[model samples]
Target: MFVQNIRNICVVGAGQMGHQIGMLCALGGYETVIVDVNEDALKKADTLLQSIMEKWVTKGKISEDAKDAAFSRLQFKTDLEDAATNADLVIEAVVEKLDVKRELFAKLDKITPSHAILVSNSSTIVNSLIADVTNRADKVCNMHFFYPPLVMDCVEVVMSDKTSDETAQTTMNVCKQIGRTGVLLRKEISGFIANRILGALQREAVHLYESGIADYKDIDVICRKALNHPIGPFELMDLSGIDVGYFVMQQRYAETGDPQDKPAACIEEKVKAGHLGRKTGKGFYDYAKEGVKN
Candidate 1:
């Protein structure tokens, strides 16, 4: 089926990532269902969407009518099967765990229409592992989105060895239709494109910090001023959450067995202490208030 023909899209998760993605789809004129297993999560998505709409209105980015139209295009649900029953594409954005993803796909495969495409927003897990739980392996692939999916234009499109050409084509087409910059991956890799490259830089940054070669603010300045990157590796890690960084590095380590994949002691220690970056107000730098604290 043509990507533009996919009118009904189901986003399976209502967390920060999933909510943003579903809102983007709704704004782009697709019939989007934002589903979560927990009713509270669905409620939270609704609240978040409302806040976003309000912000857009206040900023004069979109009219009240447009906000209403987008909200009307979205449906929030707690039942996965109900949300995906007639969906043309279902994007899973749940917790990043192989077992959880496998089990979700296993059930989703049975519930969704045979022709519906199944995709994941996973950053590390291989498409092969997730597809193993589903019968429609050909239609299963990774459609990874960075944090705050609505704002990020880049999407890593990953297809496993078993992924069919038709599936890849459709996914790429869908991404284009949604106004996203899509990079196709011919085969599975540890962290895909952006994260893999970013991870390498992060490993070195951690080494620099741990070895007292540079402090947090100085390193951040060098990266922003010299590298011209939007944010330094350490700063970005904090915003993305330290636990997420640890998980991605752990997955990379398991896949490639490379030394770079091994996260720094600081990362492991922060995660163990539940100091998961901005989300928790502490990681490499303190977010206790304003200003960066090392």
Candidate 2:
């Protein structure tokens, strides 16, 4: 019902999560535009998306005709205003910074149609902090899509007190349209649901590794073999990017000023060394040897 009104979606950012999200929207039959300032990044996103679609075709997950139709509905643009002017929904996938999001929301509030909804794909930064910058606070909420949105099936739809019921319901409808499960949080929280649980597990894992209780690989093995988990915490960090976790920690610490919320030493070190997981070909484990790309 709510989904019927959202015909066009503007995804701001063409990086990892942004590109995949744009693809999902396009496949859902929404006219989707992904905007990025860097032309090189847009080109890379196009190439990667095409490769992923081809893999889906080969896997029989989607027909070649379906892939072609999805690509036809998707567009890449450098100008934000041009991309968002007619957008019925805008999902921001930019950097995990408060100021950046606030500024972007402010601009989007002015550029988009009055009825458009503005959502953030931030993992930790809550929408409450960003919504106040826009006049349509009732339409601003968090639609947190996990990393690699093409594969992940769950999206957290978080709402602040100011968010209207219509806004939250519409977002959930959008999720269903894209063939993903949507979990709605009536109250807003910094990390929402999944990441809060994941953060605790990761913190303990990092503590065990730093304490020399067990090697990171050994811990990961125990998690996979004994606990029946799909991947170890360290491996997940590498796949998601160590710098992303580092930034999430930084945001949490800034909000709470708690020492425990600061990034783990190993994460900070890895980020500083530019060893940000599969994207950099290194993180907790070396991916260069395996020729893996995230």
Among these predictions, the greatest TM-score belongs to 2
Candidate 2 per-residue lDDT over residues 89-142, each given as its tens digit: 999999888899999999999999999999999999999999999999999999
Which 10-residue window of candidate 1 scores lowest in summed lDDT?
A: 285-294
Candidate 1, residue 206: the lDDT equals 82
lDDT of 1 by residue, 1-294 (tens): 777768999999898689988988888788999999799888878987898789899999899998999899999998888899999999998877677889999999999999999999998887897898889999999999888787799989999999988888888888877678888998998678888688778888888889999997899999999999899888898888888878777776777788867878889999999988877788878888874321
List residue ranges in candidate 2 displaced over 4 A. none
- Clashing residue pairs in candidate 1 are none
- How does residue 39 of candidate 1 score in lDDT? 93
Clashes of 1: 0
| Candidate 2 local lDDT, residue 232 | 95
Model 1 misplaced regions, further than 4 Å: 290-294
